[model samples]
Target: MSTPSKAKRKLRDGVADIASLWNSVVENHKGENPALQQRNLGMISRVLGILPHLVALMFTAYIVWIARPGSSLFSWHPTLMCLAFMVFMLEAVLLFSPISSVLRGAGYTTKRQWHWMLQACAVAAALTGFAVITTNKYMAEKQHYTSWHGLLGLIVCCAVNLSVAGGVSVMYPAIVFNMPVMLLKRLHAIFGTVVFLGGMVTMWLGLCSTWFTNNVHHDAVLALCFACPVIVLLYVMVQVGQKIFRRRAH
Candidate 1:
């Protein structure tokens, strides 16, 4: 073969190898949980796990108390969406970490089952919430996908669906769905985080919506709504990055 042709062939192979990175995350799965790190992780886990639920609860309370939204079916949209995105999805992310030895086989794999189940609920609720909002918009003769909230929500919804699909796909035996295990793991981690953060952003946008702002115009409440989930999310990100991802200290 010509030198240039050989070089081109080598380049193509290198690109493919880079696309399919090694699955080092699995190697980190086995370890003794240092009493100290486990104790610290336990507290962080509690905080990370609880804050999203707190945000969802407060939002639900706001919907019920201040909004007192009439029997209109549209009232279900925010509450259900918040429950699914902020609560269930957050639980799934914080609970089902791939690289965390503390999470694996906890309770004879009860955690894995709960993780799967929570995501299933999140997907169902998100779809139903989307349908409800769309129907409400049409019933009121308002335009669809016209606002920033709608656009961002739609993108996050798609991300949620894709994340769910990827999660499911990777659950089967390797022979059943032939794909690179490492690639699937990376995709799942990256996409799951996207869905988590994107869902929060979408909810924040929802809070910023004129419809919501007009009803509960308290700046303090808005700050609360933003602060709760974000604080937890930042903690999770920083902790996960330090522990899971390859770091200089490692």
Candidate 2:
């Protein structure tokens, strides 16, 4: 072959190699984003999330089983109360489906935002449950039984929410999910931190600070329970933030 023709042939081969390499990179990227690869609650968390509802259902049945006209559970009010509790558990099942879908369908940005929204919703839902139970118990003059059952139910709710958070963190590493999920997670993390610290401070004020009163004991235990969620929120935020910042620095 002529010298000039040989040089042209070499250049053509080099271009083909580069094109092949680029195509491989693109294929790998697509592979990573497959629908089946979506972050989801692992098997254990799904089981734990359902466990409380099952236990609650059994306990409700037991209450119904043991009740007589004169017994606490047989009264019209307690029957209604137990029914409401069951309905709330059913509501949780309905809500969890959408929550799981959002977590799965969402890109990084949406996931982060959705996660924050979910957490906020969980906290609000918890508070709402507490308020409803407390007010109803006070009005019904069934504070003792109502308080115990309501507290147990709230604790179960918190456990499930916390487990969901854990599943998200474990299944989706903060760095990889960061770009697809984006800055929303960072913003949510910061906001969650602030919300948590503020909640803790407020609870302290209401329970042990100057705002506390003789009757505060009724609310004190519940207020203290709020600390766990606050701590979990802070920890997740810090770990996720660190992963994000490290990636950015790289």
TM-score for each of the candidates: 0.69, 0.28
Model 2 over residues 1-250: C-alpha lDDT tens digits? 9998998899899999999998996677566644434433354456544544454455445334433324532233333333333333232222323222224454665654554455545545445544554575677787443333344554544554554454355446573454454454454444444434343343233234222243234554445433433443343345446656875787
- The local lDDT score (0 to 100) that residue 163 gets in candidate 1 is 84
Which candidate has the highest lDDT of all? 1
In angstroms, the error of model 1 at 100 is 12
Which candidate's TM-score is highest? 1
Residue 240 C-alpha lDDT in model 1: 53
The CA lDDT at 210 in model 1 is 74
Question: Can you tell me which runs of candidate 2 are displaced by over 4 Å?
Answer: 1-121, 124-181, 209-234
lDDT of 1 at 121: 95
